[model samples]
Target: MLSSLVVSCSITTSELLASKAYGAAQTYPVAPDRAWKIVRAIVDTTAAVAVEERREDGVLIATTESHDWHVATRFAIWIEPVEAGTRLIVVSRTVRPGAFPRALSEKEFHRDFAQRVVGNDLDSHGPKGK
Candidate 1:
């Protein structure tokens, strides 16, 4: 028998930076991390990755994105806020890179990512909108 896994693991911080460092971390058993890695690798190679890195307090923050007309661009962002709240903010967007020839498909992918991966109604709340 063979297994075909498109996504795996959790986008959990504790699991990722677990080996990196830090404590008081949390983990979520989902497909965000794997998805993020996959998105980055695919876009970075096929297209061009424009990334930005920054460090705050003790956490390493980064946002990587790529653009291509033939395929959708991956937008995976993770922000851990430490102050009055200890939470992670993520925004994953699969856009058509930009508006050009096939802009309709880009719009479709964006809609899909929002409704499926993240959720439908994205409020100023958590994943559960609480």
Candidate 2:
């Protein structure tokens, strides 16, 4: 029984490690520069550290703090210009196998990003004073 349990645990760990990274993409009605700025700000606020940034190529890599159950979660974000506007693509995965999944998922990250972008737009164009 112990041997079987050990095998099961090993399989689960292997599967987690081998899992493909997942991502989410969204297009915003804004310029790539604006989108890039927003994304960089968001990463700076959320990530433990910024790993690499390629503004010319519109790529930003960052990692979140790691806890007892999991290693740091790595994020790779890409900003691209589209016909309609700017597109943001975010891919995330665990740095290593862990007992738990990433604290934040790609979809959640996009939601937060969209909210921030819209909020920033409102703040910039809203009423002049209170």
Candidate 3:
């Protein structure tokens, strides 16, 4: 397990919905609706098609198509509206343990997800930034 290693980044602004939601979405490059399109593409084009199983109360649950080495896996994305901004919490759990390994998936996630999801916003405006 990752101990004391809280990997997170955020952007803040005066615009409640704008800065909060927009900043949380780094790779959007446009508005929220456009961002959704980008997100949908990522999920659809995954190794195997991953469909959203549950999405309620700012939380999303998705499962990938099972394969030989890649068994079924669940990924959760939690969007929490905080006082200053919205917090995006992400987690992935291995349901089947799979024939290969799940950590590879985790690494893949770290590789492109962060920047694609919210790296742009972070780059544009973060901490003392605009």
Worst 10 residues of 3 by lDDT: 1-10
lDDT of 2: 0.63
Encode model 1's per-residue lDDT on 1-130: one tens digit a residue: 0011112212332333443332223323335443343223323332333433233432332222333544332232343444433232333323323443321232332333343244423222212432
Can you give the TM-score per candidate against the true fold?
0.24, 0.67, 0.45
Instruction: Name the weakest run of 10 consecutive residues (lDDT summed) in model 1.
Output: 1-10
List candidate 2 segments past 4 Å from native: 1-22, 68-70, 121-130
Candidate 1 vs candidate 3: the lDDT winner is 3
Using TM-score, rank the candidates from best to worst.
Answer: 2, 3, 1
Best by TM-score: 2
| Candidate 1 vs 3: which has more TM-score | 3
Model 3 bad stretches (over 4 Å): 1-38, 47-50, 53-56, 82-86, 97-100, 103-107, 117-130
The whole-model lDDT of each prediction reads 0.32, 0.63, 0.40
Model 3 TM-score is 0.45
User: Please, what are the lDDT tens digits per residue for candidate 2 over residues 40-72?
Assistant: 666665544435677886677666666764556
Between candidates 2 and 3, name the one with more favorable TM-score.
2
Residue 91 miss distance in model 3 (angstroms): 1.7
The digit string of per-residue lDDT tens for model 3 on 1-130 reads 1111111101111111232232223221244433344334444445423344233445444455456655455555445455544444445545543354442253454344445555442332221322
